[model samples]
Target: MKEGNVISERFLLNNERALRLFNGYAKDLPIIDYHNHLPPQEIAENKQFVNLTEIWLKGDHYKWRGMRTLGVDENLITGTASDKEKFMAWAEVVPSTIRNPLFHWTHMELKNPFGVNSFLNKDSAMSVYKHCNELLSQDEFSTQGLLNHYKVKMVGTTDDPCDDLKWHQQLLDSSFTAKVKPSFRPDKALMIEKTQQFKQYVQALSEVSGIQIKDIESLVAALKSRVEFFAAHGCSISDHGLAALPYSYVLTDAEKREFESFLKTDGSVYSNPDAFAGYILTELSKLYHEKGWVQQFHLGAIRNNNLGMFAKLGADAGYDSIGDYKHAERMSAFFGNLSLTDQLTKTIIYNLNPADNEVFAAMTGNFADGRMKGKMQFGSGWWFLDQKDGIEKQLNTLSNLGMVSNFVGMLTDSRSFLSYSRHEYFRRILCNLFGTEMENGQLPDDEEWMGKIISDICYYNAEAYFNLK
Candidate 1:
């Protein structure tokens, strides 16, 4: 087999300025990964993988989706197949993922920590697997070691409201270098339509907070207690996953009473699930404002479409897709209400659909109070859009509609430690964009000014935005 690097040092650095900016400014900057699904227990325990599959393939829905696309069998993909078998199956599909970002990401990850530069395919599977597995056994490849290897200063793991956060506390107590802060993810709290899940969540929240959640008032009180509990644990960020921002008025006394009755006995879902969510979210945002936390909304995901597969594998198992939802009016109303009462806090909004890029970016400008730099953020391209085209469109849209300079940049939003390679991917693309513009004489050719802006978007802005410094 021919042997060579899959990606060179200048892979995405399209111009001299792009190369200069990436190497000098963006490459070595410490990462502030403010949002991800990294398991706190794995980080706290310093778990080491037995093989490449354990760390790389396990829980990686992106790869799983790609494998499924080429008609890979269920057993090899996610079933009772041996670890080696699944890794081999994924290797078989890598070459076929030519235009996909997974193709770039797979090669980038292989090159970075494992140093296996040759392209991964059926022919090279065993060799690549053995090489990476050998490296995974090292201390530097351990979970904490990987974070340190990438110079991750802080990681905000998505956590539920009812989460005990014992693992987070363990990280805080340990001699671990990176700050593993929890970001309060109360998505299930807004999912009242999932009757069984909602009830269980309320029970769990009550158990942890010692608050009896009998109605909307009690539920709000319970949520508030959890918010304070999370803040005590060094968490100053909150996240929500929604289809779209739902516009609704604050519940009246009569409506609150009606919701209380509905909570006592499940009946017809209390008029509108969205309205209940909006009311609760409004109340929660007020608490977020009071606590000075940054709130994030990842909107427009239509999840669990494949019910048969959903039953077999569950959510986040490569079954979700981008949702088409109108945003402008509802968002304006939602933020408008928060602004009216001075209850608005620093917020980041992520859109899954590329069509909503301009809408999401413009919405951020509507609520910027001038009290803080980039107080309202158009978040990084996320979920289905976490790739080259998505990132470019998001950046271009933000530049056209708002200030891209103050943008708090990229995040992993991934379950794998190897996903840190995405930061390099984003930085190279970012530098390329700016470099191309400079080469065209669209912007002034001052290295210092452009370099500082690059560094800020890559690291410093997020540092100040999340108060991580």
Candidate 2:
């Protein structure tokens, strides 16, 4: 029943209490976003967003999935609903999403960006919405302005080979405050079973690289050229999203030739999807090692099997679900295959299934040489695991099995701008974990040491791991 105050002293914490201890460690640390899917062109142009809804709610499948779960229609999610209406819908559902990471992230965004101290519900939605929309129109809320406000030092954007790198070039040419680098993601190109799209992509890549793609050899050459092009533009990493680790037995030249011949047929090669994907991943890993680039494998996501929804809305419209793949032992074989030949570059493995966190986390350490304690990383909690519970589990698993002090930190892994609040969410959960541990005497109660650990997880590790300046 009390009126909400925008900036109450009650919310302020001086450097004297447990909350103070956490905030002191958290505040002002630079963000090193090692992997994300932000549109580089937006960053290159320093684009100003139209409103909070446009920036935050539009392209985020996480929120969209929640909205659908709450019975909001797809029209509102990906179709024409005014920003105000969509935000109101989000507000209505926000309270019900308690115990979900979205609740924390939503409040954090509101509190940090607009200084709103109240919860988002039907009653307070309009007030909070109007306040954020107004702030978004200000010069201080531009993309560059927001990154600067967050103290982000660098961000790695997922880019395809067919990209022209014009936006990356623009960032390099201009004096941007934050460094924006590209991460080559060749999934769409490598998954050649999607024939029509694959052929179109080949033509696009060929045109971009000025190479004629008549056979598998030329296709590999074209891909190689694009990789060099990406590296020249400051890309130091390559990312692949797969359902599981690539563990196909080494293929013979005869087998590869037969596969290529199949591709030249009806343009549909779904007969042996795994063999083709495995072959491409091996070749891609070879390329990664040749260039000394860190390779990221995001495995265990099962995507878009709902034909009706897929036909109506297309891919990534929130139809994807998690897979129950037997990941651990197979993944060991995959990484072992790469390790035996000493062809493994610095690798980061992100598992979608939390059940395998311990397995994956422990498995990653086995591949790490003592020379670099954290060279091969167990990536942050991803997809469904991006929330508080998920992040905590991952951090704990890594802390128990590996070194949390050497973590690569939080990545948006997002398609929307408002998702930056994910970093703050991760920082808060991280601090809370350390604070509780320190309070319970599980860890030593030393602020300076804890501060350094917090900084390392939030920023430093990614910088050192990626060799980002």
Candidate 3:
């Protein structure tokens, strides 16, 4: 186990007769990360990490969910437990997660950063913990170091209209090699039911744009101004998260007028959530068209309903679950509504449930005019499926039903820095799948052809699809 030893002959290019054919391309390539939740300010400032647990475990709901699944107490998770204690608790749960993607990602981080090969557990936790903490103190493991380690070329971070964009400005002004761009995510502003927060957001947007938003038209104007501000800072994409695609049977002008009236009277119009959400989506799409930006929709997440826990720990603390939405038909209607007008921008649809893989993969092709299969993309397997099995299934489904060659590759979809190991994990599984297919005579053995496929999935597809420089 040597430092910076990411690929191994035994595993990456395993000599096992069945897996050898997979090792055809470079292990490291420039990453065009089109989507993620990383704070733009941290990247802009080139922040230094403090410890292994703080960087890896804090604010990571995936690990938090796993810990809860193992029955580890909340104190060990989000409570006041010391970092070392939490690491020990996580180590105890590791062996049980043998076949889990966490097992692989944890070891990959350890091997790549600290050069430790020993399995992490009660016995080895202290040494591995201390070693990683020490390395993190050095210049090589800083935020920029991690991005360089993975060769990330560009990243689009989720941001709200209220954000000052100071951090984004910092990135543009910095000398760092990786490009950090802002992406407008206006979910909170649109979730008008959250009255206080929504009003605050409106005030912030009005202040930022210096335009008072008194009505729907003025609100739209303020948002457009913010989008232009974001674009000036290299934003070319906007993201929305919803439990399901909005299909409200086409609101009539009178109905839209009433909705606007409701907003003025009550400071909100979400009393009929579906219709309001649908109207907002349509308006947002129009904005996207005017700006010539990509629009991303991450659908099918069931969020917090556990009142007690939510009040205590706040949102995204492991209470969120997948939804059982009627995804295909609703998605069709949603797209159908967009198809009526040619205002649809380059779009990417991401689903949380794997059961919808065939549905989503099949859905993308119906919208693709064959002029470009990549234009309407089934986004990378997100949140719940941001793992090895999830990524492999997505690739296979896209390859079989749609054009895998045109698919954009991996995205962090994470709030943690160490989660970049996910890209490495995705690449390994991708290579193995292609290699196994080539070995089985299901695909060509030509390295040139295989390498092109590998590079497309790794970097080129995202670069070409997003028009990233």
Candidate 4:
């Protein structure tokens, strides 16, 4: 294959039939970025990027982590380095990320939107930089324009309970045809460990909800008000990022009051933080179900490992890692409670620890009640697992444990405008997975039937599962 065609026509697929299905059906299907970190304000304002580095490297901890591994200076990586200098530094590091997924992603991104077929590196850096920068300067290369160019049908951006979602409202009214919506993310509200931050967050919630949060019940009421506020704006999803699913039994009011009294005398420590988190999560799920929303749990993340770097750069700056958290029992208890109460909304569970793949896959089946097509989803490969091998493994595991046809697949889960092509990358992998099965006689070599399955996995399943009409 030619260097320019790094992601060639038959890139990941093993056969022509699968390749045809991908290119014809799945490739052009509109993207539903059901979960992501893309700023809604950028889309609302239709902001134009000054240059490639500002857009590509900014707030992208994935690339930042790789550059840091190469000993790239903080100045170039995230500090006060000039745009050209940072681009040059990134170009130098590009060739070094050969076997890494960043290598493929970088080249593919360069091909699309930028329309640059030439490779990206120190040698071609200046030319590629100048060329892409010129393109980005145009009105068609603005933030909304980039999203539009990728044919994004809808995007569900992660949002905090405290956010007003004014940008989402603006995008709804803007000339942009694509739907921009918010996904309620209440991670901080449930995190009661940080007394100071939690107090401040509660105060903010009180101001928003006009509820005096003197106790756990009042806090839940404040959160419920925010949920109502979010629902009014057409939010249909709630996302949680938790290290582990908390399952400790919540204390009764008497027990909680006694602990609160004891804490006053002890000067530190309160009632069980685990019970607090579990109670809040359960209450939130009930609200989610009542609102007819999908609840997503992103589990097993060990965040902010390096305190020094976390202090310097703050959270989500490549300081997190995959965590080994016991999930099965707590997950069962939590989700089971929802089901028993008939408050189990459509759910998606994403496990960061790949070791728990089978556990999660099988668990999804345990909750599969014949009520909905895919009421419980083992979510697509996410964040750290959004690459070739990871993608394949997830597909295989889901296929083995559940109906792969019912699987909703491939979210950008990214913070970059240019990351939409991840959907294409995933489509190629999906086709390859099915194609390999066909070639091995595990699945029938029925082109049209196979094509429909791949198409659904790539686009329609998510559309239907999320009710994104």
lDDT of 4 by residue, 1-469 (tens): 1247666788777887668778776888999889999998888889999999988999889899999999999999989999999999999889899989999899889888787766688989998888889999998899888888998988999999999899988877768788888999999887767766766787788898998776767778999999999998879999998898898646678756654453234244555778888888888899998999999999999999999998998998988999998999998988887788688899999999899999999999888779889899999998889999899899999998988999888898888999988988999988877777788898899978998998888889889978886
Question: What TM-score would each prediction reach against the true structure?
Answer: 0.98, 0.92, 0.93, 0.96
- Residue 179, model 3: Cα distance from true site in angstroms: 0.4
lDDT of 2: 0.80
Higher-TM-score candidate of 1 and 4 = 1
Candidate 4, run of 10 with poorest lDDT: 259-268
Q: Encode model 2's per-residue lDDT on 1-469: one tens digit a residue.
A: 2335532332323224346554677666788887888899998888898877888888777788899898987777787888888888888998888877677677776776667768889998887777788888898888888888878788889998988899999999998878899999988876666778877887798899898876657777888898899999999899988888755746567766775676567645555566666766777788898998999989888998788988888888777877888777777777788788988889999999999899889888878867775878899999989887898899999999998888888998887666777887777678878877787788888988888888788877788888875
Summarize candidate 1's per-residue lDDT along 1-469 as a digit string, tens digits. 2448678888988889889989999999999999999999999999999999999988998998899998999899889999999999999889899999999999999888887788899999999888888888999999999999999999999999988999999988999989999999998888888887788788898899999888888899999999999999999999998898877857778878877777678544667777889999999999999999999999899998999999999999999998888888888999899999999999999999999998899999988887889999999999778899999999999999999999999999999999999999999999999988999999778878999999999999999999877
Model 1, TM vs. native: 0.98
What is the Cα-based lDDT of residue 274 in candidate 1? 78
lDDT of 3: 0.79
Identify the candidate with maximal TM-score: 1
For each candidate, C-alpha RMSD in Å? 1.3, 2.8, 2.5, 2.0
Q: lDDT of each model, Cα atoms only?
A: 0.91, 0.80, 0.79, 0.87
